[model samples]
Target: MKRKTIIVLVAAVAVALTLVAFYANSGIQSPKQEEKFRIAKVVRRDLGASVQATGIVKAMVGAEVKVGARTPGKVVNLPINVGDRVEQGQVIATIEQDDLIARVRLQEAILAEVKAEHSRLAKDFERDKQLHETKSISVQRYDLTEALHEIARARVLKAQAELDVAKAQLSYATVVAPIKGTVASVNTVQGETVTTGLTAPTFIKIIDLDRLEVLAYVDENDVGNVKVGQEASFTVAAHPSTDFKGRITSIYPSATIQDNVVYYLTSVSVDNREGKLMPDMTANVSIFLDRRKGVLTVPNQTVQREGSKKYVYVLHNETSEKRYVSTGWKDSSYTEILDGLKDGETVTIGDPGRK
Candidate 1:
């Protein structure tokens, strides 16, 4: 009886262990039976092909202005600094015009006194002339009075001309902006002596940020295709990864060679109304001149090659539908489908192994 009981116990244990193993194995999923992955089929309606080149962003109208005194003087005030916006004819700085104004006042006073003296002398000379002619006054007296009158008249004219000069000098004390732009640099500050009589010493640089352009260099091979008015797009290092649209407004007739490669200079118009872009920014330009439009497309990862045959698995009825496909134009993120794909069909981009 004991031996029979042991045999029964062993049999029951073995049966229970087998049942647990069967349930665990049933829960496991097979590779071929895994759930299908979903992907998008974005239709490429119109896509442009471009030739890319590295270039720089430049302002269309940039200027370096020297807010200096036409007459040498101490700078009383410099209202603007680097990165300040200014308008045309705005007074940017001021010089001490006190000396010039004082000189003008002195000249004016001297001019008034000289005119009076000349008038009195003129009367005296006329009277002397009449007296000399009648033998009442000597010729020497009349000649001396005439000489004094002429000197007074000449002095009056000289003082008036000097007054005009002083007025002109006074006007030069105020430094004004010549263009409407943002102040790019400030070389000198308040109380600094900046002389402008000899040469244009730059005190500040102003650039019209609203009017911006990109200088692109196209390679010799692609230069032939690049033409004025061609559409272009680019991104600056200042605003990296953000795209900006522009057009090829100009193309140089000449070619430049560097490191044994020839390239043509091209200019593009950029709109920087937001003022986010600055001068001398390196731009990554894409001169797009050609495009292709609307057709079936698939994710680049969806299409796989097997022994020179491209195959894609699409999803339908919750199952993977395997099919051969052909591809066309592709970019960094998308691939164009030429054949073996239909609209609204969900394609698989990866193996459906995980939940």
Candidate 2:
């Protein structure tokens, strides 16, 4: 019984010793594991600050045009349709020009008759003047002949003016595109008569797809940071993987309210040379504010603030050392370190006070 009691005592002492050794090893390994995973090295990289906003693709000023008929006439021929590419001065529609041509011909005939009458009266006036000089005609007769010649001249002038007007009306019968663009809509069809009222009746609507812009509704809080000539990038739902580039061209001063949130309209110039972008498409835009190149940066979570001062816990010989730093621009993932940090140094990524 004495031997058994001594053995039990020895086993209890060994188990307690083993447990203390295991706990001591675990405590020593904890810091090493934390340092391995929760630490980052300071490095030099390019950092940029940007503002995000939703936008819509739109046509620039004068990029969209509505072609209308200037004269009232029946649509005789409609040569263009929607999605058709039209050049400037190309005939898009033709009106019934038969009546117009007839009017022009009638004016021409009236002008010819007046010219002939004027020539005959000039001869009579010359003969009368010769008679008057020779005393073979009275002064009253000479004045009468002269008056007839002047009347004929005035009649000829009036007739010529009528002919010019008729010609202009004839030209208006043919509707031509004033700009080079794609036809968006055709409002009138063949056999439909268009009447010109206070405003010309719209016959077609055309849009210049190449001259597209983005109307980004930037939040009022971020409007101050945006300026003209700033570079921007955006993505459309149609082309999710493709990033379109542009520049800030303008900012509207008036604030637009939507659901109680005030926003300012910002115009961004788009390069749609590839022809992938379309008008009215929703866009996700990012306006780049400031950019820094080859600057020392640390992970954003590694920096901690105390009132007006900022500091980081840098790893020095396997121990965390508190170091305050002056920061420059901050991006989504990193912060630019302007002072109190060195290249190739490791810093804690989270609060060092937490185990």
> What is the C-alpha lDDT profile of model 1 across 136-204, one tens digit per residue?
987889889999999999998898899899888888788788888888878877888777655757677
lDDT of 1: 0.78
Candidate 1 least-lDDT 10 residues: 29-38
Runs in model 1 deviating more than 4 A are: 1-47, 62-66, 110-161, 291-355
Cα TM-score of candidate 2 = 0.65
TM-score of each: 0.57, 0.65
Q: Which portions of model 2 miss their true places by more than 4 Å?
A: 1-47, 122-147, 292-355
Local distance difference test, each candidate: 0.78, 0.89
lDDT per residue (tens digit) for residues 284-305 in model 2? 9988888879999998888887
**What 10-residue stretch in candidate 2 is worst by lDDT?**
28-37
